[model samples]
Target: MTIPRSSCLLLAGALAFSACNTGTEQQSSTAAADSLHHIVHRYYDDKMQLFPIDATFNGEHQYDGLLHIDISEGFRQRLDSFAGRYLQQLQGVDTSGLSSNDRISYEMLLRELNMTRESLQFHDHLMPIHQFWGLTLTLPQLGSGTSAQPFKTKEDYEKFMQRMKTFAEWADTAIANMRKGMATGYVLPEALVVKVIPQLRDLASNDTGNVFFGPLKTLPAGTDTAFASAYRHTITAYVFPAYAKLQRFLQEEYLPKARSSSGIAGVPDGKAYYNYLIRYWTTTNKTPDEIFDTGQKEVARIRGEMEQIKNSTGFKGDLAAFFQFVRSDPQFRIFKTPAQVLDSFRAIEHKIMPGVKQMYALLPKTSFEVRQTEAFRAASASAEYMQGSADGSRPGVFYVPILDAKKFSYVGMESLFLHEAIPGHHFQISLQQENDSLPRFRRFSWIGAYGEGYALYCEGLGRELGLYTNPYMYFGRLSDEIHRAIRLVVDVGMHAKGWSREQALQYMLENEPLSEDEAVAEIERYMAVPAQALSYKTGELKILELRRRYEQLQGGQFSLKDFHDELLKDGCVPLSVLEEKMKRRFE
Candidate 1:
């Protein structure tokens, strides 16, 4: 995992261009940066050709009406060709005369192209669809809500229905892909398949109040009665059956052959795939055993922090008993409605925005908002962050599933807010989008280790942003941290170690204050997607480690703003690229 710095290492003794100068030097730097910008735009546009949805999020709307993504042989070949050429183009850029920020951007661009190529090597196409993070979920997410699906015009509604027609075809491809995956031993577990069945039923529902009926409900309100009736018939006659056909195909063909194992390691080359994914997400070469052990150590340390809080509150009880108290406590449940659940997050923004100056000198131009998770999916939805439209019209959003908002507590409120809002995804991703100087590929992007790792670090700033004062709130921080730490153990444990779903649930419930229901959902999510949960804490710890190392090396010269600006100025990258960028600065 230690990439040899043979050619253009971007490592220590890599090159020391960090020198001061006068007017002409500044002008040359500016011109060099301008040239990089033009090339970066080309890189971004080329990437959009490969990932259109990402382009839509990046603010390019030419692909706006498109919903279906082609994953066949020709498309893959074209994507691979584009990525290789992009990497070549990036290498061709002259970073030897660039500033530190430009240099970081250059390395990040190379890392991203390489990661794209590496991801292409996996049979991700074989498992192109899943019940969870696959196309099925993504489609509903886009069509059901404020994503790209416009409801203001009659044409928009028709566009979406047109899009749904394509889904039946996609579903067939999905089933075929899963069948191929079964042949290759890349199937989902039977248990996970069972969980997915109910979801298919939800999608195939005939209910008029369904989220899928959103376009129907608000269909201009001005259409002629004939057209209105016709629209209803089209939905019932055409759209419904498309969903039903897919529903039946999955039940009859795909789900039955699904694997009996839970972890990614259970699939073909699962062990090696997960190891590569670990390196990809953590941006380091740490093995599952190393990550699992690190998680355990963090869990124990965080538990001690929680215990100290417990003692301060005069709660003389065991950790499990305390977890029970928090789960059942009336004091924590202040939310009376879904709006209240939403208000909890917005309130945190207002209260904490004043204190942001304490730790941050740079703030994202893209705004953040809190919304309820879309209705039909809310039951299955975990709290999530949706990045803004690349054009800046739509702000970054934190959607909390407030199915029964009255049930939510303020215990983990601050941690959730910090992780989802300012300094988390909103700040990290939006800043990258607004930064035009970095290659288009680097500015608006995702790398699990860097993105989630950076968010995890955002969670760490809860104390500094002035929210850890209340003892229970402080415990919430520890609770959130513990949940991530446990993901390390339970995620790998469930899949790689053949641990049962119940075993995973028990570990979480015993160690964290999450309700049993929440624990059940999380364990199933881990079951559905192996090694994904490890990204948060594993990535975060590495970022913190890098920062500490940078501070030590810079001594009195370290500027926190420059560190953040330099790190995030480029879009997300593999941890290795990130480390190399920092190594250049620190060394």
Candidate 2:
């Protein structure tokens, strides 16, 4: 992300010209820097206009009433033009004269612009809705009263209603796009299509059970009855019908045409698409073959560790048998209620705070919380973190989806807390949002390799953070790591190496301690979002490599806290940019 300065001025004539040249250069640099600043701010403003949902999530309420039909051709063209325009403007900026941070911003924006332009060649809009993401799932969360969408005032309510109406129109566009995908070969796998049907059906339901109606429960006291009536009417009239139409379309039309193959390779140019995804998610040039080989080595190495743990516990069987024991044993499934599961995570937070303070000098000003994932999406949702507002009005939340507390194992709780809460996402994200020094886009930017990788790396900090004393908890930490390694194997295996869904599932079950349901969900998540699974392990390895390199180079002077702070200080960036930035700063 850094731009190297121009080399030394050479000859007598050049030296004679240096004085006037220096003044001219100074003026040019100032102008270029000013232009770059304008482009950066202008791009963010335009981006917020196009992606209003993101704006709302980032605490920009001005865009709350807008919802773009992102799947539509018109929207896609507008997005392409937006990227192209900003990219052209950026090319005019002189990077050689910019500050280090401005150079980073320039490079980040350039990468984003090129990636967006390149990605437009793919037909991503054709298959708009997926079980894991897309507006179908996202809109419900926004309307649920607990998410980013505000409902504190009448204006908030009206804004959401506008969004709801637009969403109905958006559904029709999605249906049309999906039909176009069906005609082409870009349809979802049948397994994923089935999962989406039920989610839509739940949203489409007319009863009070519909999540879109959730806002009504928390209306301010003495609110006008007509406003409440209008809210319910909007859900029933616009939202329900939209979900119903999408459900019917998916069930009757899309499902019948859905591909049976689990991998994106079944679609036209799918391999190329997956290659783009690998570059996009990992932010690296490593090929699928390289990643697959890394996964194999990691899996073998972690399995050996698991075996040692199994034998230490005097388990009467091999690693596979011990995995079963962990999954089924009553000791692991100790939580009887959702509250107990949440409490366990909170307790882990308390246990790790002293270590968290010691391990890092920097911390977020924003508060953090542990909450249950909503019931409507809990079945398919993974445990996740939602960043708090930049203004710190709302606390960042670590959502644990507890479908059955009896089946919820305590083994991974410590690692999970470290990954999703305190030092993982909440710290990385909140600090970025709070740092007024960064440009708006860089503060909110998401480079999956850096973000997810940092979180996965946090999982390895269990021992350093005063937990993982128990063999099972340590095993859980290893299980999580191996799970990510398994992703490196199976994600590339399925998407790139022509492995079947069954083959991937079997590989997961044999390698990790995931339950049948958990295994299926994980595998399908990889299937739905190609190459995304690679981010965690790919990112974690790079970070760990950087830490080791710095430790060895600095020797006695190496400080883990200082290293952690420096690494996270810029928030998330491409792995290459991160390496360059760290090398320049530390080495």
Candidate 3:
């Protein structure tokens, strides 16, 4: 993500406001702007205190030692109160004379507060541990020393020790919460629970190669021998035991009670929950049926494109056969080792840079990298970008899962890199994090419709970026896009329309070039986290529509660079807010 000089001027104007006002009026406007900024910053500061682990990720190191059991009833009550308090404070701010950027911040915060308060009604706490997300997955990454938690100092190590101790308590609370969920019919799906069991069991291992020992392996030079011993002791005594306890609870107690139904709709008030999730994840009022229909149309349109590519390649059979050939073809499976797989993605990054530099006047200051996903979670993980620290200590990482390099398909590599690495998540997220003019909350805020949508939209830039020249690579781009489109259909279908896991898996396999393993991982991802899979396509379509509207409006005057800068300059925003902002700028 790059900000053009014009955007810098816009930000300047926003901060200083118009110079035409009389001195007295200008002072009043300044006061109101100051007040609004205070409110939003205070709101963000309080939120960081409430969610300290997130604060750590955002590079606020002061709260690194703190770990809140967020699913606990007491914690939820505090969170609800925090939102209510902010909403009340925000209502007092006068916005009539505020800058456009300040107004967008106000609107974003207001919606966040309301949504947070409203979402508390759901029993999400009852089933806090899920296969796709939760502390169960996140804590290991943090403790790995390769992640956000700093291990450069003795104090840093001590802080993490405290976090490890608190995590044990968090796991106990999670167990209690899950038991309550079991009593209330709010437990996880059996499929997800089974996946989680092994993860916990693996974490419980006291083996020297355990991920929890990662920090001890890479301890800074001149570190005290005694502290290192204590760290190992903590992992052995507290961390391993904590995971073991959690594993036993899931395996012995919770697994039998896990719901057989695949969707969130299987739980109490499940339909209403899914509907709320639709709004939360997509940031839209779109009904599940609406999204499902959009998925159908998009799938058909992309399939037609796939057919053309198939014919261009002179394939003898139908689209399904082409899919099979692409999936199993040795030509597509070019990597024999994980390093080769990674190098291919790096090559895609290098290949696209010249065109990317030409198309965008600005680029992220943050460094980026491509890395292998940790082996423990690779089996279930999807390729994703982890944002770099605001201070630039960590580079934004694109983690690819390569369970078997021999089976790794190059077909989607170009598109995948375009989406998850260079100009997709890396650009969108890094730009948001780097923009200093926006309020901190807005800078770090994630509206899936805006963020993921922008990333998905970037995939279409593949051809222009000079990497999708090969027919198979172009087909790969389509495959990635259609994968998201398929998500729209299957995520909504299973969660809202009562489609089974098998049906969802079948839908994915029939519609895309994914293997059975790929299809299963994707379908089950939707099952574990309902409506989340809907974000990529939903956001992508809205972004694409906005671009077309602006292109048509501006005609020859339209600068793709300007459009991109404007889209990213304000950072992640709700689609509605993004549309309003774009219209105000270009219309």
Give per-residue CA lDDT, model 3, range 1-587, as digits (tens). 89999999998887665553466677887998898888888888898999998899899899999999898999999999999998998888778878899899889899999999988999988988877777988999999999999999889999999999999899899999999999999998898888888988998998877888999987888998998999999888888999999999999999999988888899999999999989988989999899999999999999999999999998999999999999998998777999999898898888889889877777999999999999878988999999999888899999999999998988888888888988889988888899999889987788887788888999999888877789999999999999999999999888888889999888899989999988988888889888888888988888889899989988999998888889889998888888899999898
Residues 257-282 of candidate 1 have per-residue lDDT tens digits of 77766677777677777777777666
TM-score: which is higher, 1 or 2? 2
CA-lDDT, candidates in order:
0.75, 0.92, 0.89
Ordered from best to worst TM-score, the candidate numbers read: 2, 3, 1
RMSD, one per candidate, in order: 7.6, 4.6, 7.2
Q: Judged by lDDT against the true structure, how good is candidate 3?
A: 0.89
User: Distance from true position, residue 517, model 2, in Å?
Assistant: 0.8
Q: On residues 242-278, what C-alpha lDDT tens digit does candidate 2 reach at each position? A: 9999999999999999998989999998999999999
TM-score of each: 0.86, 0.96, 0.95
Best by lDDT: 2
Q: If both were scored by TM-score, which would come out higher, candidate 2 or candidate 3?
A: 2
lDDT of 1 at 192: 67
